[model samples]
Target: VRAEAIITRESGGGRAFHALVSSDGRRIEADLLVLSCGVRPRTRLASDAGLRTSRGILVDDRLRSWSDPRIRAIGDVAHVADPRRYAHEREVPGGPAGLVGAGWRQAEWLAGALIAGEDPSPFAEDSPGIVLLKSRHVDLVQGGEIVPDPFAPGSGEVASWADPRHGTYVAMSTTNGVLDGFVAVGMPRAAAELSLLFQRRGELPSDRSLLLRLDAAEQPVRATGRDETVCICNAVTAGGIEDAVSDGCDTVDAVGCATRAGTGCGGCRARIAEMIDEWQGQHV
Candidate 1:
């Protein structure tokens, strides 16, 4: 499996793929092959057409190609090059976001611009994008600068814990007690709390160990903050959901349609439902 080079893949009759032949003449047979390599923008056609490209098709604030006004790029193939767009200190290098939420935002904006026939506000970057991986066997959530070296100059407190046997790990770094970087694996509750703190720029508990308790033995856990985000994909907060409910969005689907909260990934639907129930209980 660690062969230096995968020379060829052979397909047998009646099978989608039969075997992989390595440079060392080893033939590995498998029922499925999963390639986990990351993605790159497919700009070959644009490049052949003599369009400007750097990391992706170079675009301005309006998502129009710098080289060709007629050709616009969005989604993972756009590198928005507007220097004034990103004012944050931790801005990512200029390139395509390669994220579904970002793509949706771009599509919506572009559609509106085309329909109204007027220039809209420049598309903005969503810094510190949340990453979530949910599976039957593993759960992971990460955001921000997850690995600031504790020994580095100007770095803040860094705390970490790992339980490999239980497939659990948590690490966080704070800037003046504010959660700036974090990562969690296999600890869903802790991960959720960390995510909220990260979104709110909330201070971590003075005793970092308190977070471990949330995931330790899987005790009852809830992160209590309505101003913090719940639907990261749409940047919707618990407070936003409450407002929607107060505005007569009585059902989960109604809330989704009103705020576009649970429309993406659907990871926050249960929380949206819970918020609705809590609101109704209080009002009654």
Candidate 2:
């Protein structure tokens, strides 16, 4: 027997990657093939732009590159100082932690620096965040269930949810009511927020149900202070989507193709569509 793999293109794109196999005087063809892929630090552009590129673009405690005083890079494209001590020794990963919250923190610091005309210190300098991954689930936990402090060093926790049938598991280390780090499986969404809360050393909500409500909802609820990203893959916020509609991308598909808001997993597609309708109704 022989095997063949085929892949399909999205949209109205023509059929491509047709594969075939023949054995024992018979032939077999495949119309679809799926493959898992991995990602690496992409720093070529930073290098081209005259920034010092290490495993990723090396940056100072402020997330500003050493080679270029005016340039700042963030997300997976830049490497900031790692503060984790795994196995009792400081460990520096080739890439900075990759997460929507991490990027948001970086962006916020960069914006402050740009507006103030001076470099601002990295937001999560005291506590290093951790990524929790299991199968299709991922979470970032920064602080745990502690009062008076959310991210007291070693007090934060991260958990992941891979199977709804099985109870979730959370691993965390806390000290002095502060969160240090954690790895969890089966609850990434909650974990991601916990990670942020810990990094910010912000107060945890007295009612955990509020967090659950926000997480389970299909639409984003307005929260005061610090804008939350509705479409993480594109770094687009609720306000950004409103602006995009005002500037025209008047449909979910158009907004997605234009801003890549709903391109990944498509969980936010419905929300994008609703926003488009609301914008058009009010303006047009």
Candidate 3:
């Protein structure tokens, strides 16, 4: 429903109570609402800590605090600067992705940076954003750059398959034969398959029409390498799942129980299942 205006009050006013919209405009009604949310970047703590705070806590590409390298920031709390640049604006990274994947990537990088005592290479500034919506029988996944370089050498192609009734829209662009930008909606298998290609930055075949096919007749999006992550939440790798399958984890639930992979977020459950099938075929 496209809400043009929020009707907080009954047709006419004179109401003792009204529904409350959330930080992002979600309706919630109660006699006394205990609120704990903010749409704005919370910088009070950083300011109090004497850290330079702007739209967010300013941090270098390494995610180190501008004032103190010992302190690091990640996710929505920190504004990451472009690591490639070193100027007055060097400290100002572009807008934050504000996505879970962004934070997860930061956490993973931070873990490595702390151990190695070096900056996280290919940091979050340029990492693609993934949009996911999962439910019992519904699935949606979008990732990669939204706008591709139109004039770049060996420019990518844009393709899409949409179905409004099912609320499905899949649009993607590939540059120099690589799967780069894509938006997948209500296409679980296709989206899941395409995601791996996008993440891998893998090259597409000479005949790329199969990728845009909305039907099940479309070709598979290629297999996952053993080392690549199939489930980010549990840090489960494709090889790990293969080992589990070798020990007799046949179904998604079984694999989850064995490795605790899909128990969180459950975004990778489909991919996990796909890998299990691929593994079984190879073993057979």
TM-score leader: 1
Ranking of candidates on TM-score, top first: 1, 3, 2
Span of ten consecutive residues with least summed lDDT in model 3: 1-10
Query: What are the per-residue Cα lDDT tens digits for candidate 2 across 62-99?
Result: 77676775677787777775323322333445566565
User: What Cα-based lDDT does every candidate model obtain?
Assistant: 0.76, 0.55, 0.67
Candidate 1: the clashing residue pairs are none
What are the per-residue Cα lDDT tens digits for candidate 1 across 1-284?
Answer: 46443333445644365566776778787765655454599999999999877788888888988778787789889888863453332443678877667787788889998899976888776446777653335567888875556787766788999888888899898888999989888876687789888867889999998988877664633335666577767777777887899999999999999988888777777768777887888789
Best by lDDT: 1
lDDT of 3 by residue, 153-263 (tens): 655577666778867777777777788877777765566557667767877666655654533545453343565556644556677887898899999999988877687
- Once fitted onto the true fold, the runs of candidate 1 whose alpha carbons sit more than 4 angstroms away are 1-38, 82-94, 107-122, 134-138, 148-156, 163-167, 200-202, 212-223, 248-251, 280-284
* Superior candidate under lDDT, 2 versus 3: 3
- The best-first sequence of candidates by lDDT reads 1, 3, 2
